[model samples]
Target: MSLRPVVDEHECALHGDCAEVAPQVFRIDDVAVVIGTGPDELIMAAAESCPSVAISVIDESTGEQVYP
Candidate 1:
């Protein structure tokens, strides 16, 4: 299964924790942005590390939310 990472701009705090966790997938600017995809583990780590809980992981095949 492929994982996609998404950042909620409204909830983002510019903490950059997600980028630090998965730089290849997420970038920090005014807010966290999804740049590209990485391994599922990396994506999940990034989402979990977000201090604001602004990052969410989705199952690309099922379109289901995988993480909070």
Candidate 2:
């Protein structure tokens, strides 16, 4: 499955957890930014690691949210 990650800037605390979990996929600047594609599991892991719950994962095939 193709996963797309969206970062909610307002909710982000700039903790860099998401980027730490998946550096290839996320970068930390003012907030976490989706930088590239990664394995489904890795993407989900990154989203789940966000302390502020700022990252949302979507299943590209279904256009449905798969992670909180």
Candidate 3:
């Protein structure tokens, strides 16, 4: 499954938790940015670690939301 991580700019507060939890998948700057590809587990972990729920993981193959 190809999981893609996307950051919701409106909800992101630059907390960096997503980056801390999965640096390979997320990066902190003005807001969280999806930097590169990673395991589905890591991508989902990054999304779940966001305190603001700014990060969302989508299964590109299925068009399904994988994280809250």
Candidate 4:
């Protein structure tokens, strides 16, 4: 899996929990959150810390998905 991060804008509350949980995977900017590498391990942490359950993790290489 190559790894990918999908954000649900409607579900996100801009709390920055994702960034806090995994800085390398999630970053907060002026407009929206972003993912740099989207590794499964880090992205998983971010998703777990997300209070709003807005972050979804996906593996592009293998199509392996992480459940939130």
In order of appearance, the predictions have TM-scores of: 0.95, 0.96, 0.91, 0.75
Pairs that collide in candidate 2 are none
Please report how far candidate 3 places residue 41 from its true position, in Å. 0.5
Query: lDDT of each prediction vs. the true structure?
Result: 0.89, 0.91, 0.87, 0.74
Candidate 1 pairs with clashing backbones: none
Candidate number with greatest lDDT: 2
Clashes of each: 0, 0, 0, 1
- Residue range 1-68, candidate 1, lDDT tens digits: 89998888999999888888888888888888899989998899989999999988889999999888
lDDT of 2: 0.91
lDDT of 4 by residue, 14-57 (tens): 88888877787667775236757755677677777888888777
Better of 2 and 3 by lDDT: 2
Model 3 bad stretches (over 4 Å): none
Looking at model 3, the pairs that clash are none
Model 3 accuracy (lDDT, Cα): 0.87
Candidate 2 RMSD computed on C-alpha atoms after optimal superposition onto the true structure: 0.6
Instruction: Write candidate 2's Cα lDDT for 5-64 as tens digits.
Output: 999999999999888889999988887788899999999999989888899999999999
What candidate 1 gets wrong by more than 4 Å, as runs, is none
TM-score of model 1 (CA atoms):
0.95
